[model samples]
Target chain A: MRDAYHEELDSIGEGLVEMARLVGSAIGRATTAILDSDLKLAETVIEGDKKVDDLQHDLEARAIALLARQQPVATDLRIVVTSLRMSADLERSGDLAQHVAKLARLRFPERAVPQDLHATILEMGQLAQRLMAKAAEVIVTKDIDLAMQLEQDDDEMDLLHRTLFQHLIDDRWKHGIETAVDVTLLGRYYERYADHAVAVAKRVVYLVTGEHADDLQQDIPPVTRVEGA
Target chain B: MRDAYHEELDSIGEGLVEMARLVGSAIGRATTAILDSDLKLAETVIEGDKKVDDLQHDLEARAIALLARQQPVATDLRIVVTSLRMSADLERSGDLAQHVAKLARLRFPERAVPQDLHATILEMGQLAQRLMAKAAEVIVTKDIDLAMQLEQDDDEMDLLHRTLFQHLIDDRWKHGIETAVDVTLLGRYYERYADHAVAVAKRVVYLVTGEHADDLQQDIPPVTRVEGA
Candidate 1:
C-alpha cells in the first residue's frame, strides 16, 4: 500500500511536469501566431488548451482520491494539497496562453503587434516559456535553489511588461486606441503567465523548505502602480 | 467529537462570509475613491487589504489543521477543501479591489473615469458590490439557486466591461493613451472582482449539489475575443 501511495505521488509530479511542457509550448506558439499573424497556429493553440484542461482535471481527481483513500499526514499531506494548487496555477497559465492565441485570431490578417514592438513581445514570450520550464524543473527535482531563482527570472518578464506599457504611453505611439488595447492585453497575458509560473515555483519552495514564500521577500512587486506623473 | 468537528467547520464558514463582506466593502470604497479622486479612501482600502490577507492566512491554517486532525472524509472533506479555494478567490478579490485603490492613489487629484463614463463605472462598482453580497449570502445559506444567480450577476459586469472598451475604441475617444490605459485597467479590476464573486458562489453550488459549475453554462464568456471586424 505504501509503495502504491508513493507511485501515485510520483505520477502527480509527472502530471505537473507534463502540464508545464504543454503550456510552455502553448505560449511559444501563441507568440509566433501573434507576431506572424498566423491564424492557423493560433487556432491550434486554442484547441490544444483542452488537453491541458483535461490533464488538470485528471490530476485533481487523482489527488483528491489519494487524499480520501490514503488519508496522508504531514509532508505527504502537504504534497497532495500543494499539487492541487500547482495544477491550478498551471491550468491558469494555459488559459493565459489561450487568451494570447485568441487575440491573434481576433486580429486575423492584420498584425496585432506593430513591427517595432515585435521584438519585445517575442522576448516576453520566450521569457514566459523559460519560466514555466524552470517551474517544471523545480517540481520534478524539488530543487529549492532552482525554485528560488524562478522569482528572479520573473523580474525579466516584469521589465518587459513595463517596457510595453511605456511604449504605449509614449507620445510617439502611433497605434490607434484599438491596437493600444490589444498590446495592453497582450502584455498582461505574458506578465500573468510568468506570475503563475512564479506561483508554482513558490509552492515548490514551500513544499521543500516548509516555509511559506510570503514569509520571504517577494522578488516581484504585487501591483504595478503608476508613479505620480 | 462530532459536535466539535461541526463547530470547527462552522467557524471556517463564518470566516469565508467575513472575508466576503470585507472584500465587498473594499470594492465599494475603492470605486468611490477612483470616481471622486479621494486619496484618503484609496489609502484606507490599500491598508485594509492587510486585514483580508491576515484573515485568509488564519483561515487557511485553521482549515489545514482541521484536515490533518479530523481526517475528514466525503462531504466533510469537500467542505474543507472547497473552503480553501473559496478563501483564495475572496482573497484575490480583495487584491483586485486594492489594485483599483492603488490606481486611484496613483492618479491622485484626477478622476480615473471620465465624466461621460462615470455612470457606467459607478454601475459596475455597484454591481460588483451586489454580487459579492449575494456570494456571502450563498455562503451562509448554501442556497444553490442563489449561488447560481451570482453568475448571471457577473454577466452584467461583463456587459459593462464591453461597453467601456467600445467607448475607448470609438472614433470619438478623445482621452489620451494614459487615461485609456487607466480606464482599461480599472474596468478589468471591477470585472475580475465580479468574477471572484461568481467563483465563490459556484463553489457553494458545488458544495450543495455535487455538480461542478463548469458543467453548467458559463455566464460570462471565457475569453474576450473580438469577432471578425
Candidate 2:
C-alpha cells in the first residue's frame, strides 16, 4: 500500500515535468511562428495549450487525493503542496505561450515583428524557451546550482526586453502605432514567460533546501519605467 | 483542542479577507495616484504592498501548520488548501496595484496617462477595485451568488480594457510612442488585476459548490490580439 502511495506521488512529479516540457516547446514554436510568420506553426502552439491545461487539471486532482489519503507530513507534505504550485506556474506559462501564438495568428501572412527587431524578439523567445527547459531539468534533478542559474537567465531575459522597448520608443522607429503596440505586447509576453519559468525553478529550490524562495527576491524587469521625455 | 483548530481555520479566512481589503484600497489609491499624478498617494500604494505580502506569508505559514497539526480531511482539508491559493491571488493583485503606483511615480510631476484617455483609465481602475472588494466579501460570506456576480463585473472590466485600446490605436493619438507604450502596460496591469480578483471569487465558488470554475471558463481579455492594421 505504501509503495502504491509513493508511486502516485512520483507520477505527480512526472506530470509536472511533462507540463514544463510542453510549455517550453510551445514558447519556442510560438516564437518561430511570429518571427517567420508561420500560421501553421502558430495554430499548433495554440492547439497544444489544451494539453498543458489538461495535465495541470489531472496533476491537481491527484495531488489533492494524495494529500487526503496519505495525510503526508513533513517533507512529503511540502512536496505535494509545492508540486501543486509548480503546476499552476507551468499552466500559466502555457497560457502566455498561447498568447504569443494568438498574436502570431492575428498577424498571419504578415510578419508581426518589423525587420530589424526580429533578431531581438527571436533572442527573447529563445531565451524564454531555454529557461523553461532548464526549469524542467531542475525539477527532475533537484540541482540547486542549476536552479540558481535560472536567475541569471531571467536577468538576460530582462535585458532583451529592455532592448525591445528601446526599439519601440526610438525616434527613428518607422513602424506605426499599431506595430508599436504589437511589439510592446510581444516583449511583455516573452518576459513574463521567462518569469514563470524562473518561478518554477525557484519552487524546486524551495523543495530541496526547505527554504522559501520568495525570501531570495524574484525577477525584476530590466527597465523599471519608460524614460520621460 | 479541536475548537482551537477550527478557530485557527477561521483566522486564516479572516486573513484572506483582510488581504483582499488591503489590495482593494491599494488599487483605488493607485488609480488616483496615476490620474492625479499624486506622488505621495503613489508612494502610499507602493509602500502598502508590503503589508499584503506579510499577511500572505503569515497566512500561508499558519494554514500549513494547521494542516500538519490537525490532519484535516474532507472539507477542512479543502479549506486549508484553497485558502493558500486565494492568498496567492490576492498577493498578486496587490503587486499589480503597486505596478500602477510605480508607473505613476516614474512619470512623477508629470502625468503618465494622457488627458483624453484619463476617463477610460480611471474607469478600468475603479472596476478593478470594485471586483476585488466583492471578492473580499465573497471570502467572508461564502455567498455563491455574490461570487457568481464577479463574472459579470469582470466582463465590464474587459470592456473598459477594450475601450482603452481603441483610444490607443486611433489615428488621432498624438501622445507619441512613449505614452502609447505606457498606456499599453497600464491597460494590461488593470486587466490582470481584475482577472486575479475574479480568480479569488471563483475559488470561493469552487469551495462552496465543489465544482471547478475553470470548467465554467475564465477571463478572455477584451482584446485577445492587438488588432492588425
Candidate 3:
C-alpha cells in the first residue's frame, strides 16, 4: 500500500510537469500570435484555455486526495501545496496570454501602436515567457540559481513595461480615448503577466529553500558589504 | 504530546482571531481619520500596524511548527492552511488601512470634502470596514450567512468606487493633480479592502461547502423555480 501511495505521488508530480509544459506552450503561442497578428493562433490559444482549466482542477483534486489518503508528512505536504499554487499561477499566466492575444486580434492595426514600441513589447513577452518556463525548470530540477535569476529577469520586464508606458504617453502618438484604453489595458495585462511569473519564481524559491524569500525588496539596492567593512 | 499539540493549535487560532480584530480596528480608525481629517487617529492607525505585522509573523511560525511537529490530518491541515491564508489577508488589510491613513495625513484638509462626495466616501468606508469585521465574525462564529452577506456587501463598495470615478472625471471641484492622486489612491485602497473581504468570504464558503463559489456568477439574481420543474 505504501508502495502504491508513492507511485500515486510520483504520478501527481508528473501531471504537474505536464501541465506546466502545456501552459508554457500556450504562453509561447499567445505571444507569437500577438506579434504576428495571427487570428488563427489567437483562436487556438483561447480554445486551449479549457484544457489548462481542466488540468488545474485535476491537479487540485489529486493533491487533496493525496492529503486525504496518503497522509503525507511535512515535505510531501509542502510539495503538494506548492504544486497547487504553481498550477494556479500557471493558469493565470495562460489567461494573461489569451488576454494579450484577444487584444491583438481586436486591434489588428486599428489601435495604431507606434512601430518602435512593438520591439520592446516583443522583448517583454519573450522575457516573461522565459521566466515562467524557468520557474517550471526550477520546480522539476530544484535549481536554486535558475530560480534566483528570475528576479533579475523580472526586473528587466519591469524596465520594459515602464518604457512601454512612456511610449504610450508620448505626444507623438495622438491615440484617441478608445485606443488609449486599449493600450492601457494591454500594458496592465503584460505587467500582471510578469507579476504572476515573479509569484511562480517566489514559490519555486520557497519550495527549494524551505524558507520564505518574498521580502525581495525592489529597487532599493541592498547595502552591499565591502571587504574592508 | 498530542494534548500539547492541540493546545498549541488552539492558541494559534486565538492569535489569528486577535490579529483579525486588530486589522478591523485599524480599518475603522483609518477610515474615520480620513473622513474627519483626524491626524491623531491617523497616527494611531500607523502605530497599530506593527502589532499586525508581529501577529502575522508569529502566526506563520506557529502554523509552520504545527505542520512540522503535529503532522495533522485532513481537517487539521485545512485549519492550519486556513490560518496561514487568513493572516496573509489580514496583514494586507492592515497595510491598506495604513495606506489610507498615510494619504489622509499627507493631504490634511485645508477644508472639508464637499458634502455630497463626503457622504459617498463615508458610506464606502463604513461598508468596507463592516465587511472586513464580518470576515472575522464569520470565521469565529462559523456563521455562513454572515459570510454570504459579505459577498453581497462587496457590490456596494464596487458601486461607490464607480461613482467616485465618474465624479472625479466630471472635474466639478477643479482639484489639483495631487488631490486627484490622493482621492484616486484612497478609492483604490477601499476597493482593495472590499476585495480582501470578498476573498475571506470565499474562503469561508469553501470551508463550509467544500466547493468554490463563483463569486461573479453569484451576482446573478435568482429566479423562482416551480416545484414541478
Q: Judged by lDDT, which candidate is best?
A: 2
Model 2: colliding residue pairs: none
Candidate 2 residues lying further than 4 Å off, grouped into runs, are A215-221, A225-229, B215-220, B225-229
The predicted structure with the larger lDDT, 1 or 2, is 2
Taking the tens digit of each residue's C-alpha lDDT, what string does model 3 give over B124-192? 788887887788787777788888888678877777777765655463645533344345556666777
Task: Residues A1-229, candidate 1: write the lDDT tens digits.
Answer: 9999999999999999999999999999999999999999999998998899899989988988888889998899999998998998898889889888888888888899999899999999999999999999898888988887887888778778888888988999999898888887788778878988999998988888888877321222223533542
TM-score of each: 0.96, 0.97, 0.74
DockQ of each: 0.48, 0.49, 0.16
TM-score of 3: 0.74
* Model 2 TM-score, 2 decimals: 0.97
Give Cα distance to truth, residue B125, candidate 1, Å. Answer: 0.8
Cα displacement (angstroms), candidate 1, residue B119, comes to 0.7
lDDT of 1: 0.86
